[model samples]
Target: MNFLIISKYFYPQNRIASFRINAFAKYIRNAGHSVTVIAEGDHDMDTEWNGCKVSYVKNKIITESYLRDKIKRRKRWTVRRITASLLNRIFLDYNLFWGFRVFKKANKLFKENRYDVVLSSYMPISPHLAALNLQLAGHKFFWIADMRDEMSKHPYFSKKYKSAYIAIYERLFLKNADLVLSVSKPILDDFRKMHSSSNYLEVRNGYDYEEVYDVNFQSKFTMGYIGQFYDKIKPDNWFHAFSELISEGRIPKDSIIKIIGNNMKIKIPDNIINNVFEIESVPHDEAIRISTTEVDVLVMIHPLGRKGVYSGKIFDYLATNKPILALYDPDDVVGDLLRETRAGFTVKESDIEGIKSMILKCYSIWKNREVLPRDWNKIKQCRRFNQTKILLDYLSEHLPNQ
Candidate 1:
């Protein structure tokens, strides 16, 4: 079976969604199925990837170019947009331009070769719009709208467009596509309430293994978090949780806390500064190796308001085999996954005593040369290689001989 995947990024880009699609493309090809990807890039180019093919669709229009350049200049930070023009003129309008370009290119590609299945992955949601155009125009294919994250519950939308308009938009998107998939259950629940007729499912993100350096875990108790830090994830709260312990000298002053890849510059006491290591963003493999081998504990911060926002980092952290210390909401997907897998301990974001207790427990294990009681079999359940089987099964159900 030949599958056409439409995404905004692909291999060599190394974004969250890029890793998922890249791993799937390789795994599917290894399973004796051909995979073709339509992704965003500069200058149209074709390449063979693990026995599959990839086509690049260039964004060449003025509005698209202007928005792209502005984003590039801003270093691709969406939060930097503060004006109405940035909100109304570029984001809302330019994305449609991007959709038009994607549709034009995808329609041409569809004509050249017939596809058994069409998988449109979303981040910007332009690819879905483009594929929706082709599907609506009587193109025949089993269309699957895959949301790597929640589209309808996206936090970017303000009060004016949050609930009413986005819900309708999500319904239309799901109603048009034959099947819909999201990264978490809450995301599917958000869509299912409005569009009960469409096929809704949850597809958890998986970790992709890569090369890493061999690093011995240091004698000092280490807790590492290797990812970006933004408004929603409040690391300072964790510090406040430890304030009493640190001040009382129960926790070692030299105990290391590695906040790699991101540094929010939390104002810890002078005594703790030597123990706090803030590393700037490093390459993916380096980040993984450090988290997996160098740290005794991995710290993960859950978002405050984004209910269904499950970062791809969760599975990656799980694969590291280090016990996770999740400062999370019970509503976030990580809460249940951690409890179910027994891979980590979870504390409410505001529960200072709970956070302190978890750290002390982990420290006790580290000091006594004891292993974290992670259910290895359960942890394997979320591996990226294993996830391909789910995708393949879905394909077999929809298109025979997958």
Candidate 2:
């Protein structure tokens, strides 16, 4: 099968969409499909990547200036990300033509090749619009639309009221797609409610075991959180919970709390700074190794957001099979997965006291048990490889090469 993956971002972007597309594309190629990825070739870029054919289209507008740096850093030094975010939101239109250029290239590819399927992942819903363009050009290839996070239904954008028009465009474009894929069941369900007749599937974000299982366990009781840090989801409650244990001397002063990813934007409270271990952004493999081997307990912390919004890290946490202390909204997707797997404990985001109790109890459980609860079968089920296998079966059944 000849598959064309249309995504705005791919490998090295350090984003959820990029990671999923990169992994899936590689897996699809490994499964004997010829895969080509069309993406934004902004700035100095390469034309191909590891077994996959690649094409790059230049962004119509590029902004790199002192003013941009000032805007980017404003959030780090102060509680001003929201302000920079609003200004940045206003400037997105300047690059609208980038999507159209890629769309044109995708259309040309469809016309020239006997493509079996066209998969477009979104955040920039431009890819879906691109797929729609190809379909309208008399090419009826199976159009698979991937949604990492909902467009209009996203808690951040829905509250901002910034991109209502684009959201409407996304819904209309997605409705016409041959099939839709989402990371969570609730997200897929939400789309189903919006478009009753459309077919949708859940292909969750997952862990790469090879990357995680290599690291030697560094310490016995390290509690760590990785991934982007945001002001809205600051670790205030997290610190408050740990503070209780610290004050009670239940948790040793030498025990570590490792934080990876973007911590510059959200300040870590000074009280816990002595025990905090900060590592700047590293490659995905390195981060994964750090999560599973270096950290004793994996922490899944999220802000109290609207229903169905779960951190992409939940699957990764499960893969480690480390005892998990998931701090999330009781009604969100993370809470749902915790219940389904029975692999971890969930403390409501607002319940500091309950979180402390869970933490202390987890410590007690760890001290008493000879081995950790590393459920290998349940963990394997949530991985990207298995998820991609399911996707492959779907493509073979619904969009087989003629």
Candidate 3:
């Protein structure tokens, strides 16, 4: 089978969004299927990765550059916010110009190649917009619309009118998609409610790498968190718990809390500032190595009240096979996953005492060099290769014979 994947995010991007489609393309190609990727890039270039071809398309309008420059010039926040809001109301997404370019490239490619499947993932929504354009133009293929996050019903939406307006486009895309794929079951269920389509599937994000490096735990009990904090997700509670633990002498004064790739301004308590080290973002591979080998505990933060959001970082943490300390509502899906895999402890973000207890538990495990029991079979099922197989199996059974 030949596949054409349209996504703004792809390999070499060093983003969590890139990992899913990158894994799919690599594993699909390894399975003896031809894979072609069309992705957003700074420059238009052709490249190859793991036997798959990729075409990077540059945006013509460069709206992002303009907005970035405006910020650099210290534009008024209120003015910029108003202007952005107005533009968003008109365009739905800032990538409209890029979406047009992608559609043109994809349309040209479709004319020359007999693609068995056209899979497009979304966050910026440009790729899906491009794919939808091709479908609207009468191009035929098994369209798989992968929603790593929700669209119209996204929790981030502050304006009901805007969400309602976006729903019109969402319905149109859903109606055209042969299959709708999401990373969460609840997200897929929500999509089903909007479209009344039975062609939806939950393809959870999985870890791509299997090679676990030898554990080189730090001398002091160390906790590590990778990636940025956004939308309701914050590290305030975790920091508070850590501060309390230090004050009570439950953990060593030298214990470290290292955060990588967090650009946001975190309010670390004055007492723990010496213990908390915030490192600038590193490459994805290096981040994985550090998470797998260096840190004694990996921290995961999912905001309360946000259903069906499993930050892609969790799977990477899972791949490390380290004890995870997830701070969110314990009743959420992430908590369930942690329990099912026996990989970590989940504590509610608001429960400071619970957080302190879990932290102590992880510290004890590290101090004793004890390996926590893990369900290797269940963990293996979350591997990218296996996840790709699940996708392939479904496509083989459901895709129209060509």
Best by lDDT: 3
Model 3 lDDT tens row, 146-222: 99998877875648987887788789789988998899888888898888954988888888777463566688899
Q: Between prediction 2 and prediction 3, which has the larger lDDT?
A: 3
Model 1: per-residue lDDT, tens digit, 214-234?
Answer: 324558888888776766676
Off by over 4 Å in 2: 44-46, 63-95, 160-164, 211-220
Question: Which pairs of residues collide in model 1?
Answer: none
Per-residue lDDT for 1-402 in model 2, tens only? Answer: 888998877865666667789888999999988999987664534377879988877654542232234444553342333443453477333335666787778777766787878898887666777878777778877788888887767765655455576567667866788889888888888788777788888888887664243233444567888876665667778888786678778777666788887535555556667887777767777877777778777787776765676667877778765777888876677777777766678888789888988888767655664335455676687778888998998877876544
lDDT of each: 0.74, 0.73, 0.84
Q: If ranked by TM-score, best first, what sequence of candidates would result?
A: 3, 1, 2
TM-score of 1: 0.88
Better of 1 and 2 by TM-score: 1
Give the poorly placed runs of model 1, Cα more than 4 Å off: 60-94, 210-216, 263-271
Evaluate model 3: give its TM-score.
0.93
Error of 3 at 55 (Å): 1.4
As for TM-score, the candidate ahead, 2 or 3, is: 3
